[model samples]
Each structure stands twice: as structure tokens, then as C-alpha cells.
Target chain A: MGESILSGTVFAAGISVGPAILPGIFPLAPLLAFNPFTEPVGVIHYMIVGAVMFTAGVVCMALKRNALGVLMGIELVLNGANINFIAFSSPYLRGDGAPTLGLDGQLIALFVILLAAAEAAVALAITLNFYNNHATVDIDRADDLKG
Target chain B: MTGTIRMDSIFTSVLLHLPAPTAPVVAAVDWHSVLFLLFAGLACGFAIAVVAAENVVRMALYLVFSLAATAGLFFLAGADFLGAMQLMIYVGGTLVLLVFGVMLTAQAPLVSIKPSASDRALAGIAGAALLAVLLAAAVSVDAWRKPGVGEIPSPTATPLGMALVGVRVDDPPAGAPLTGRSGYMLPFEIVSVHLLVVLVGAAYLARAKRRKTPRAIDVLASSDPPSQGAVLAAAVPAVRTTSGAGGKSALLGGGH
Candidate 1:
């Protein structure tokens, strides 16, 4: 029972930390004395991770009938992009003097965020229009152009 | 002996006590990175689930979790101010707005809205492809992969604040210290204006929706006169049938 709950939370839900997994996979106690303040090894592995959020967001936007679902997709897409931008700007993660984006990446990310907000507003406006006219938000029904 | 030592503090000692082969894995694992990894995975996973789940309320919940995790990612990546901004603006402010919208629009029992299975399959494939392309592009470069990023001193929030006005604060390398780092003051101002507009717009959209009757409770109250104590009597199911039998529209007309 313990194993079932533990495994469910860890792998299925993606809640368990790597250290916990390591301790389970191998056999060792965590370094409680290893002060997190002192980061000897920097942020290489952080960038390599392909965010699953981005893909999920895409699927939602494409498949869902609700306007909110589409909006969530946009947020997810932005989040995925954000992971990259942050990884690039993070001095702790990048090589020393490796022509990293530094603050530029963050600046670009900020623009993307602003643009995304604008897009959401415009999309919501359009959605409200559709709702007023048709009384439903199902995009599939928006086939007046088909005839 | 175990009582004398806290289990976590004795990393080396704990390793000795545990079985072999894990020594290498334990030695390699960095706890600092572990925190970020867990949070990031959560933000990503819940986001996907939000897309999959049909319930709007549940979607909002997932979105809340995802945004919170992103804030954690920001702090972990050394964007402390940005992280705080994310929490304040994205989570606290924007999410509340989203919930309000959900509640308002949730008419007719407000339940799950399922899409076609074929649509789901197609989107899943498309999303998977996009992810593959993006992931491939992100990790393909050599500079990001093994950056060997040296010790970067955590900069003060003061400098970041200063640079928002168009000052390049992160130490520039060259003749005449490049003065072009634009402070974020302009964008911040713009975002403030944008949010104000959004608030006015959302309020305008939701104001005083016309309904046939005020409410179930109001309809009952209006049927009985206060002088005759009919208001109190109106609560009885027997009185409701007679008063309400006149048709709900008639009761509302009698209110005036």
C-alpha cells in the first residue's frame, strides 16, 4: 500500500524530487548539510529538459470547444517558451562568457508575455461576440463560412 | 547511535549504512537542482492535465498550480523580482479574474464539455510533433548544453530596478561601459495601463444581465404582503402552490 501510494505520487503525478528518487533508486540519505546556498555545479541540466506543458497546451487549443481552453493553451505555450528564456538568461545555468543572452532573453520573454496578454484579450472579445450571436462557445459551430 | 545524528546531516554515514551501487548515484545527486526539477515537472504536468480535464473549475485549479510552479522556476533561475511579479500579477490578480469569468458564464448546471475523440487524437499527434521539434531545437545547440557557467554573484534587486528605465546594469565589457540597458519602467507602465483596461472591460461585459425573475427567493417574498404577515406565511409549501400557481410571471408583476 505504501509503495503504491508513493509510486503513484512520484511518477504519475510528477511530484517527487530527484533526490527522493535517487535515494529510492540507489541507497543514500540526503545531504542535509549540503547548504543549497553554495551551488558548486551550475545549471546545465535545467535547459535540456523539454517542458511537457507546451505540448499539452497545444493539444488543448486544437481540441477543446471552450474559449478558455484555447486561452490555457496559449498560457502553456508561453510557459514552455519561458522555461527556455529563463534557462538562457540564468547565469547559474549557462557557461561563463559563452555569449549567453544575459538580460536580453528576459527582455524578450517580457515582450512575449505582453503580447500573449494582448492576444488573450482580443480572443476573449471575439469569443464574447460569438457567444452573443450564437449562444454557444463551440468553435466547431462557427462554420458559417463553409456555405 | 542513530539518535545522536540527524538522518539527513549524516550524508556520508547514511550512505555507509545503505546498500552498495547507490554510492555513485547518491554522490552525483545535487539537492539544489532537485527542488527546481520537481517544481518544473509539476507545473508542466498539471498544465497538460488542465487541458485534458473537462471541468472548468478543475482547469482553473490546474492553471493556478502551473503558474505557481512557474514562479518557483523564476526564483530558481535567479529572477527573484520576476518570480514575485509572477505571483502577484499572474496568480493573484489574473487567476481571480479568470475564476470570476468562469463563475459568471457557468450557466445550465456548468459541467464538463467534451470534445470529439478524433479531435483529441489529432491534437495529441500535432502537439507531440510540435514538442519534438521545439525540444530538438532547444537542446541541439552546444553553447546551452555544456555552458560550464562559472560562479555568478547574485545581483541586487536595486540594479534590476534601475535598469528598467533603459540602463544596461549587468556589467558591460568594452570601452565606455555601454549605457543602453533600458529600464523596464516603460513596459511596467504599459502593463499597468493594460490591466486597468482589462478590468474596465471585464466589468462592462458582466454588468446587470437581464433575467426574467429576480430569483427563486425574491419571487416568493414578493407574493406575500408585509401588513398581513403573508411574507412569513409564504414560506409554507401550501401557500407557495396557491401564490405560485398564479404563474411565476404574475407574482413578479404583483411586486410593483
Candidate 2:
């Protein structure tokens, strides 16, 4: 029994190591090719970071019960989009002599920040009104219109 | 054994002939990528923390850190004006307002309302799918994956300012048709008016009003379990009266 168990362990190790040693078969090999510390970052790097933030925001919006939490999620979503705009607009990030988005991207990001502030103010006001009316900030309790 | 000995002898000879160790070869660190990593890690980590944290105040705090780090990213990307705007308006103005809203409504049972297990599972699945799609799209673009040219452009504040007021002082890029680029003066005016309208509307919506009779919420509050009900019942009258009186005073002051 001990010999059989030892053989099974060896087999399992082999199975795990086989794909990792092969070039194309390794799943993470593609990702490992680019080293961010040694190589300069590009627009794609910023987009990936933005994507993570955007996902977290969507999850927050979907899962949170507090109105303010939802509002925070909205802010996160806007911020993720803003990062993309900044990355695309950056002259440094463009390769092959491509024309960057120039001032337009920064200008749009500015407007997004401005609009986000306005939206937050209005949303907070609406939330306050809802809180005063219902005496609760739990969105689940907002069922008066649910006919 | 003989073949192994022969291979060992050749390997030793190769090692002995190698150049003597002198200055250690250190790989040059790209400060831009290092800073990008630092800021991106902070932003993404805190953003996830905002989602994971149960406490409302902690979530707000995490959001603040995330946004501040995002401002650092903007600075790293060469948008000095936008970065400053992000710090002043987003972290300073909007987050402060959000915190105020949180403080105002954070009664005991409402501070951390845990979502149901099913809701969390569903949202997790959906968010994972969305992230996969977005990341795939982001990485699939070959042009975007190419390393940047590392050329820092001139300051954009002057051009941005000029463009906002109907002047396009910045030169067009090489080989680009310049005739179609339009100034943002029209949108700037519209945004200004929109902000004014939103300011008034929010104030109007949040104004305290006197009620002739107790509403459904008041009845519900009174019927709640004694511990929570007593606290809410006591707090409601105090808050209502204070805000109401304050609103009346403000209106009177405006009249004067």
C-alpha cells in the first residue's frame, strides 16, 4: 500500500510539472513574457487596472444595500472610465508614431469628473429625501412603488 | 561513470575560462513602470477593499484612498491639470459630500446591511464575467500592447484652458487634418448651466418640510422593537425640529 501511494504521488507530480515545463501548454506563459518592471508600460496596462476597478465597482453596486455604497460604486465606475481616457490621451503611451487623443481626452476626463460631482450631489439629495421619508437607507425597504 | 566524468571536466573548464566577476550587472529599473505599479496596486486593491468592507465608513475611506491613488496615476500619465482637479474636486469635494451623506443616514441597523448569500454569489459571478471580457478586450489590441514611446508632451493646461473658451491654440499632430477639431466652448457653457441647475435642484429636494401628520415611516419606526424604535423615535423629532428651524432661519436670512 505504501509503494502504491508513493507511485500515485509521483504520477501526480509529473502531471503537474509536465504542462508547466512545456512552452505553449503553460497557461500563464503568455502573461509571463512581458515584464512590467523591465519593460515600459503601455495603454493596455492602464486598461487592465481600470477593468479591475470597474469590476469591483459593478460588484459593489450589485451587492451593497446602502444607498451611499451604491453611490460609491458609481464613482468607481466613472473613475475607471476616466483612467482609460487618460491612458488613451497620453502621448507617452502611444507607439508607432500614432497621434494621441491629445487635449480632447483630458478635457473629457475633466467633464466626467465635473458631471460625477453633480450626479453625486443630486443622488445624495435624493437619498436624504428617501431616508427622511422611509426612516431607513436600506434600498430593499424601497417598495412603495413596487406594484 | 566515464561519460559523466568527461562532461564534468568540460563544464569545469568552461567555468574556469569565464571572465572574473567584476561590477555586478544590475538591471535598470523603469521609474515610470514602478510608479505605475505602485499607484495601480493601491487603486485596485482599495477599490476591491471598498467592495469587501462591510462598514460604511470603512468603505468610504477605502474609496478615498483608491481615488487618491487614481489621481497619482493621472499624474503619472502626464495630466497634471486633471490630476489636480481629481484631487481637489473628487477627493476633496465629492468624497466629502459622500461622507456627509453617509454620516447623516448611518443609523445603527443601517451601517452594515449584509446582502443575502444568493445575491453575493450572483454578483460575484457576473462581475467575474464582466472583468474577463473587459480584460480580454484590453489585451487583444496589439497596438495598445506596444511599449510607449516615453516622450513626455508639453503641459496641457494652457491648451485645455484655451480650448474650453473657444480657442484652439495647440498644434495638430503630424499628418492630421486640423480643420475638423472644434473648441469646447459650447459644452463648457452647457456644463456651467447644468451645474447651477443641479445645485438648486439638490437644495430644493433636501429642504426640510413640516408634516401635519405622522407618515407610514413614523408608524413603522414606532412599531419597531423597543431598543431600535426608542432610539429612532427620540432621534426623529430632534432631527426634524432642528433642520426645520434651520431651514426657516436660512429662508428668513435670504429674505433680508
Candidate 3:
């Protein structure tokens, strides 16, 4: 019984090891290691998703000449940060006895969403005004202030 | 139902014959990871699509889908109230933006604006570098990789509501002796006021401006420059708003 319990604990700990380094160790290593398909996810997985979204947002902002496209990028970036906050705040996603962000993270995320909304509204309004003044929404053409 | 019962019986029999120790752990599928992957992929993929698409309307549509997927992720992460709010407000914002897009694109000349290929390449390279840095930082943390305690906490919205009104119902973890966790009452009130201000300000800025003279473009296009100022002043009636600013009267209708 003691040996069985020890094995159970070992299995639980081993599941946390990510699948990247487990290729040749054991025949069933894929099942044992932390692949998203087989093993339960940790906070790292959520961070990865956030990072991808943020990168896409940055690319969108830098490449798009349309002012609205840039606004979309800003929203994506904010949403990425919000995802990180939610991951940290979730009790089920925290380590055993780990000092977690708890409610603080969620609260911060909520505020971020609210502020993002306000920011978007103001930004769209400004975009509209810019379009009116220049008769164009092409941000590349808005060079009136250029020396 | 009968098929499900028969399948369950077969599954039970197979499980009974297998090694007892690892059976429970092995059979349990990680639904959370599956859901996370699904939502995250949709969100990221649509975001990338938005970046790549040159058509303004298509970009707006992609953004709406991306944000909706993000709300799915929020729900998966257990922020139920936030997920709902994200759905409502983000979708509403997208709708307003879509209307703006339609309004702007009603004019045939400015429907799409494409960036040069060189700009796209440079932005892609920069984005990749940033992503590498972010991913490395995220993965380098040891504690964040650890498996969770695997227990669902109580509903988040009630305590969240309390916290917004200057009351914290949830206690800090026993191991960490934290000082009093102050609520977000101040920030909440401040944000509410800020939102109101933003709404009024946005309306003001976007409002049509009336000018007695023709638009700068029209003035520049005409040949005679000596009497341009006089001609503009006499061209339009004083009572007519002339689409507030520029020549957007056709697109915007009467200036509101």
C-alpha cells in the first residue's frame, strides 16, 4: 500500500514535466509527460496563448495603414494581458500551496477590460474626426503635421 | 441512452481487466487542455488573419471573431462574470466599429488601403522577435510550470462584486500572511466617471463641424486662387451645416 501511494505521488509529479524532453526515455513517455492532449495543462500553456495573441497584435498595429486595424491590434494586446491575469487568478491553475494572485488578478483584468472599452470608444471617435478632416482613413496619408 | 449504457458496460469490463493502479489516472481525459487549445487557436489564428487582411471590413470581422474566442478563453480560465462582460461589451464595441466601417466605406474611393510588402515583412520580423522574448520569459519561470492543486473555488462574481464595493470576502491563503486586501471601490468609481467622460468626449470629437467655406481639397482643386476665399464664403447658405466638416454630407446624412 505504501509503495502504491509512493508510485501515485511520483506519477503526479512526473506529469508536470513538459513533453519536449521526453522523446526517447520511455515507450509511453508521451502519455506521462505534459502534452496538452494527454496531460493536464499548467499556467505555462496559457502564457503561450497570450504571447501568440500579443505578437499578432503587434504585427497588426505595425503593418496596417487602416486606423481601425491599429485599433484592433490594441484590443488584441489588451486581451492577451487579460488572459494572463485570468490564468493567474484561477485557483485550479495554481500550484499546491503556491502563493497566487487570487482575486487581485481577476480584479485587475476586469478594470483592464473596462478601460479598454473606454479607450476604444475614444479612439474610434478620433479616427472618425481624422477621416472627416482629411477625407481619408489611410493613416499613412495623415502627414499634415509633418515638417 | 441505450447505446451509451452498452458502451459504458464495455468500457467497465475493459477497465476491470487492466492494471488497477494506473487505471483511474490513465482513463481521465484532460478536457480543460482540449478546450484551452481550441479557444486559444481560434483567437490567435483570427488575430493573425486580421493582421494579414488588407480589406478594412474583413479585418473588422476577423477582430470580432478573435475577441469572441478570447471570451471563450476567459470562461475556460474561470472568470465567468468577466467572460460574460467581454462577450457583451466587446461584441457591442465591434458592432459600433462595423457601423463606422460601413459609413466610411460608403464612399467608393477609400474602401481598402494596402500597406507595402516591405512594411509587412519588417513588422513580421519584429513581431517574431517580440514573441520569442515573451515566450522565453514565460517558460523560464519554474513555479509557473508546476501543476495546479486541482480544485475549483467558489463562484467569482459574487466576491468580485463585493470587492468592487470595498469589501473582500475571500481570505488570503493561510501560508502567506498578507496584509488586508483592500477592495477596488475607488478604482471602480473612478472608471465609471472616466467612461462617462470618454463617451461625451468621443461624441464631441466625432460630431460634424459646419464651415461656411468649401473643403480644403475642393479649394486646392479649383484653378482660381485669387478669389478662392471670397468664393467659398458665398457658395453655401449660412443655415446649411455642409456635413459639419469636409464633404461627408452624403455619407453622414444631416450632421448630428
Candidate 4:
């Protein structure tokens, strides 16, 4: 009886470990289960991409001392948000009977793009003025107002 | 031993249960997902590149590619007008403005100001946290995870134009609770006025200022030890002198 119980426990462990080890050997195996290339793309995929871009933009904004780099970061952040908006608006990407933003999403994205352009223009003007006065675009050195 | 035999049998059973890698299935590939993957890869890759790049010009270039890929994504999502506007305004206009800014301020010392290690680490942590939260939120909704029906809606450019002129030309989506769709004419006018104000304000802020006395920067540069700022300040007078001559010629030309 003791031997049978030990054998059963060992069998169970083997069964559990086999699948885990197989994935390690064939890394793409697990990824292929979802098979994005074969299946249709969804809003979730766009959201993931937007999330990555947004993160990168935030990091760029935080890490760059150059004023123009910060401005670029702002652009990336805006584009990321625009992607989410477009995805939400897309009728093709909606689930069965799912409510979509329809034209409103596209309109909002258009406004965002326009505003981003305007913001960039104003921001560039500000950066140029700062550079003209201080002869440096390093934002850290813009300490004249600091008490 | 009996234990070893049992383990071997279990492994065999597990392998049998696992589906064998059959011949490549000639299934119909979804071109939409392929294009989406391509554009998403380009957009995300270049966005990360923009963050990782050290040179200002390279960052701007990466930004252009990233924004262009995002435009492609907008097109894929059926926002054709938005995509065109993105290409024209974002990739064409704003990026050109950005590149000009980079060139104007591309002094040797300012081109690549690497953040301190501590700042980078802190920002990395914060960005990672934010991304985790966003991704969690994105995938948390079961409805959002459902595969799309992949039906291409009709072109919206005409309806969108009509809507801008205070008319809802297109029918609302099925099951939407809203009864009457409002026109966007008011917001459109507001944005137009806003753009005009921004244009005037930007022009005013960026206009050249002719200072009678030495500017604070020049004063500081002259007082401080010899550095890039002092060198730049020394060059500024030469530029001003040349510009003065050019301005006189322009006035002469205008008189003709």
C-alpha cells in the first residue's frame, strides 16, 4: 500500500511538471494558443499598444532635461491617447452588440491632434524664447525664477 | 524501481495528451491583425526608441516614425480623416516645427543632456507602475476582450462634415442609449478661434526682442567663469551685427 501511494504521488508530480517544462522548451507554444495572426485583432490589443506608448512618453518626459525632448514626450503621450480613442470609435473592432463611441471618438481624436499641433507651436515658441534668453535648452538651468 | 516506472508512464501519458505539432495549417490569415501587428510594432518600437535615443535630432526622427505608424493605425481603425489630419498636422507640420526647434537649440551642450541615474531610476519605476495599472484596466473588462465582428463601416467623411455644420447625418450605433445626436458646430468654432489665438500668441512670444542694455544672460556670462555660456554670449553680438546689416538691406529692398 505504501509503495502504491508513493507511485501515485510521483505520477501526479510528473504530469504537473511535464506541461510546465514543455512551455519552457517551446516558448512560442503558449503564445500560439491565442494566435493573434490567425484570430481577429481587438480593442484590447490597441489598448496594450497605447499603454506601452504612454509609458514610454512618461519616461521620456521624466528623463529628458532638454525642453524639446519634453515636448516630444508630450506628443507621444497625445498620440497614445489618440490611439485609444480611434480604437474605441472603430465599428470593426466592436464586439457583438457592443456600444461604440462612433463618430464622437473620431471627432475627439481630430480635436486632440489639432490641439497637439497648437500646443506644440506654443511650446516651441516658449522654448525658443527661453533659449534666446538663457542660451541653453536645459530645463534644469531655467532657475531664474527660483527664489 | 517502481516509482521510476510510474513517473515514466505518467510522462508518456502527458506527452500523448499534448497535441502533436501537426503540419502547418493552411488557415486563412487575418490581414487586419497582421497590419495591426506591423503598425503597432513600428509605433511602439519607435516610441521606445525616442525615449532611449540620446541625440535630440534622432529622437525627433524616431518621433516622426512613431507618429506616422500611429497614423497608419488610425487608418486601420477606420478614422481615415483623422489619419490624414494626423499625417499632415502631426507628421508633416508639428514634427517639422519640432525639428526646427531642435536645430535652433542644438548647441553642443544642450543636444544631449542625460538625466542623472537617480532620476532615470525613479522615472522607470513610476512609468512601470503606470503601465501596469493601465494594462490591468485595459484587460480587466471581459467585454473589451471579446473579438471584434470585423465589419467595415461605411466611410464617415461626409457625415462628419455634415455633423460639423450642425447636422447629425449618420445614424447612431445600434443599442446606443442616446436619442438625438448633437452637432459639433459650437466646439468647431471654439477650436478655430482657439487656433487663431494660439497662432498670434506664438508669433508674439517668438518675435525677436531688441534690448537696449545687455541681457541678463550676457551679464551673467560676462561675470561668470569662461564656459559654453560665455562663448555663446560672445558669438551673439556677431550674429546681431550681421542681422543688423541684413535688416538694412531688407529695408533698402522694400524701398525699391
| Single-chain TM-score of chain A, each candidate | 0.65, 0.77, 0.76, 0.76
- Candidate 3's docking class is acceptable
Best by lDDT: 2
Evaluated on CA atoms against the true complex, candidate 4 attains a DockQ of 0.34
Candidate 1, B127: how far from true, in Å?
A: 1.2
Q: Which digits, one per residue and each the tens of the lDDT, describe model 4 over residues A1-147?
A: 223333345344644455566664452223234445556777888888898999899889988999999999999999889898888888888777767888888888888988999999999999987776566788887543333
The Cα error of candidate 2 at residue B17, in Å, is: 48
Candidate 2 ranges with C-alpha deviation above 4 Å: A1-31, A97-99, B1-27, B174-179, B210-256
In the order shown, the candidates' Cα RMSDs to the true structure are 14.2, 14.1, 9.3, 15.1
Q: Which ten residues in a row have the lowest lDDT in candidate 3 chain B?
A: B222-231
Model 1 DockQ, alpha carbons vs. true complex: 0.16
TM-scores for all candidates: the values are 0.64, 0.75, 0.75, 0.75
lDDT of 2 by residue, B1-256 (tens): 2334555556655767653345764545567887999999999999999999989999999999999999999999989999999999999999999999999988888899999999989998999999998988877666676778887777889999999998988777543456678899998999999999999999977765445676655654332223222333433433233444444433433332
TM-score, ranked from best to worst: 2, 4, 3, 1
lDDT of 4 by residue, B144-214 (tens): 67678787877889988988888988778766668657888988889999999999999977765455677
Least lDDT summed over 10 consecutive residues: which range in candidate 2 chain B? Answer: B222-231
Among these predicted structures, which one has the highest DockQ? 3
lDDT of 3 by residue, B1-256 (tens): 2344555565666766542343334334467777878998899889889888877778878888888888888888778888888888776664466557546644555656888889978998899899989987776676677766666767889999999999999866434448757899999999989999999998877665456656555444422212212333333333433333223332332221
- Binned by DockQ into CAPRI classes (incorrect, acceptable, medium, high), candidate 1 is incorrect
2 versus 3: better lDDT goes to: 2
**Cand. 4 TM to true fold:** 0.75
DockQ for each of the predicted structures, in order? Answer: 0.16, 0.33, 0.36, 0.34
lDDT of 1 by residue, B1-256 (tens): 3345565446655666653333432233344456766776778778877888998778888988988988887777777766776787667755665665566455553346788888888888887788767656654555544434444536536556666666666754222225554567788678778867875775555333444544456555443233222333333333333444335424332432
Q: Please report, as a residue range, the 10-residue window in candidate 1 chain B with the lowest summed lDDT.
A: B224-233
Which lDDT tens digits does candidate 2 get at residues A14-130? 445554676854433434454555457778788888999999999999999999999999999999999999988887776655556777888899999999999999999999877
Model 4: residue B50 alpha-carbon error in angstroms:
0.8
